[model samples]
Target: MRPDAVVIGVGNPYRRDDGVGPAVVARLRAAGLPGVTLAESDGEACALILLWQQRRLAVLVDAVRIRPPHPGQVHRLVTAWPVPGPLEPDRGSSSTHTVALGDAVRLAGELGRLPARMLVFAIEAADLGYGAGLSPAVERAADKVAAEVAAEVRTWATATADQGP
Candidate 1:
């Protein structure tokens, strides 16, 4: 059976704070949220689209580098399909990926493969250098983001259940 929701963690774990996405996935895995599929990606556009397709809800966690960085600040947004441009305007194409998430989102919109709802949780990074661990602040934020994702999954599950088959 297909999962009701998927959480795609987009980043490279070896790149210090860029690993925030995977870190959150790890937490969710340990928590074991029912009917929630957890996945990690290197922010590849096509891979990302494939991961979330046909799900009722898709949640993505990733790292972003913004000016005057705040190491662990979390930015959350719900994308409107057929997006006009960057997911976050002021941040531009700020994702720490070769092909931005916004690009994948745009492609999904064009292909009409979007999930019923999509949410993004972008964490600010303090370091992107090659390493295995996230910065202290980013580490803490990862825990928080995991909790947030878990809550979201539960809420989605409850709402869907309430609607009945």
Candidate 2:
């Protein structure tokens, strides 16, 4: 069944701090809110685009490497973001291939497959090396983000129910 809402974490758990997204999803899974789907992707854009298709909302979590090192900072970004438009990478950069999460979001926008309401929770990355587990800063951020995203899912569920299915 198509979920009413989804939380997709885009990152590689094997790669240190980059796994923050998946970590957040892991927590959400344990929370087990009805009508919500939780998933993890190894920083794959195409998979994400397909996951949220026809959904009412999609909340994406990802790790970003940036200057000044604000490790573990949870950035709430994007809500009905204008896609198919120019997007200069800000806050941080996705440690993925040339086509990163931002590009994937734009592609979804261009393809008109974006959700009715969408949001991105970007975490400042500390380490992205070949290893398991997140850095201290990122781990804390992931836990915090998981709670916030869960709250969002609850809110969406309530609102969706109020609208009468």
Give the top-scoring candidate (TM-score).
1
In model 2, which range of ten residues has the least summed lDDT?
84-93
Clashing pairs in 1: none
Per-prediction CA RMSD (Å): 1.1, 2.0
Candidate 1, residues 92-164, lDDT tens digits: the string is 4388998878889999988988999999999999999998999999999999999999999899899999999
lDDT value for model 1? 0.90
**Model 2, stretches more than 4 Å misplaced?**
84-97
**Candidate 2 TM-score to native:** 0.91
lDDT of 2 at 129: 90
Writing each residue's lDDT as its tens digit, candidate 2 over 45-140 gives 788888887889999898877677788987787655565432323643544435667677777888988888888888888888999999999999
Assess every candidate by TM-score: 0.96, 0.91
